[model samples]
Target: MTEQNRLKQIIEAALLAAGKPLSLDEMIGLFAESEQPEKKRLREVLAELTEDYDGRGIEVTEVGSGFRIQVRAEFSPWVSKLWVERPPKYSRALLETLALIAYRQPITRGEIEDIRGVSVSTNIIKTLTEREWVRVVGHRDVPGKPALYATTKEFLDYFNLKSLNELPTLAEIRDLDSINRELELQDPDKVSDEQPDGDAKAAEGGEEDPETQQDGDDAIPTDEIDTESTVKESEAEAEPEVFAESSDETDSFDHLDSAETPSAEDDTSDQQIDVDTEPMDDAEQPETEPPAVALSDEEQTPLKTEIDE
Candidate 1:
């Protein structure tokens, strides 16, 4: 292979092998400094690799982090079947919170709550943080100085976005519902189930609040409705064994109980014998009279007189 062709092949292999996105610096490190290709040449190879995978099952794409070879979104439905466990579904509230953070980054929790017109659940924040989608950028300069959140590179990678600029414009979103629809089109893999939870339902019911309502141009997109399956066949397969083990435990307990238990007649006879033995033992003990105390004659006389009175 020519030097250029060899470089392309190396870049393609690196991206394919990398489970996560690889930055330009990391890709450059693959080659010795003396023989390393220029940054521009590396990018050109990456671009060519991306084109080479066009119309193929897997495609090389660039995100905020860098380049990665991933299965295209169009084939995810069929590809996802390989895994037994379904992806996690996010509630509308959680998605809305993420949307607000993505568009109006470095925003505080309070700001998100204000935009949504409902108190943001700690769990939603926790889930986002756990997923590494959002991070603590800094604290707002107000009384509480609430922590501000911004989207991480992982968020872009998850959504297959190259940058924040790739996000849909505010004008495209008429309302929260419209926003969700657009998001669904953009990321079908992430969006699952349209049915909002109790919190989301409540938020929707109160969406008419003036403070929470926004103009057409500024309105944020709502979470898309997701209807993906959550069941894992692998988990279902193991359930029978778990039930069998549990039943075995129960049977062992029952057997132990049967072995330790005495018959009703035996218990009654034992109790009666113990009662009879107790009375006999008591009867065998001799009864003792109280000891008499001698008192002085004068004191006795006074006591007798007082008793008589």
Candidate 2:
């Protein structure tokens, strides 16, 4: 074989056997000092290898770390069967946290929580660190000295990404449903119902609010109404009744006060009282309803005369 053919075979063997990506320097180190090829010639060989894999099941890919030989994504379904263990299932929360770290590096956990509107779980961070997909680049100068996180080359390798630049833009990320479909980041538990959640619900299929329901052909779902605003509106409607009841109570109390006080317009309304009037003591028996009494013959004399007349 020619020297060029030998060099290609050596590099290919190193890549396949390494079980990980190998940089150009590492690939070149596979040869003796005198037989090592220059980077330019190595690039040519890699190009040739890529072309050789154009229609093949496996291909040579250059990710952020270096070049690797991996099975093409098209053959994953079959290639995946070689492994007995089921792929680890990632929750949507974990995927989202990862995406944030990838897109916005040197970001703090608090900042991630701010964007996600929920606190990041400890397990999510631990998993990323354990996987070597993320690392603390530095600490922020702010209070508490929060550790700033950034994605590592292994993350790119796992995703088959060339670099951070190859990641989807924020605008593309905004189309979460489509991106989720492309990335297969759906959480089986959450998506079992097949209904979208969070920001995706509004963006995908224009789904109606869960609060509202459709009855028939005549009913069309209205826009998602704010529950808080609805509650405020109901309170506003109930305010007048509350005010009227309070006003009535106030007026009744005022009437009672007025009755107890002497009034110039109604002098005859005051009851006749003697100077020897005495207030009842606590020991006195409480007043009870008057009892009926039978009248004597003299008391009935006036009633008998009136009836006879």
Q: Candidate 2 lDDT (Cα, whole model)?
A: 0.84
| Cα lDDT of model 1 by residue, 9-55, tens digit | 88888887889999999988999989888889998998888778888
* Global lDDT of each candidate: 0.84, 0.84
Top candidate when judged by TM-score against the true structure = 2
Q: For model 1, which pairs clash?
A: 192-226, 193-226, 193-227, 194-225, 194-226
User: What would the TM-score be for candidate 2 when compared with the true structure?
Assistant: 0.58
Poorly placed runs, candidate 2 (over 4 Å): 173-309
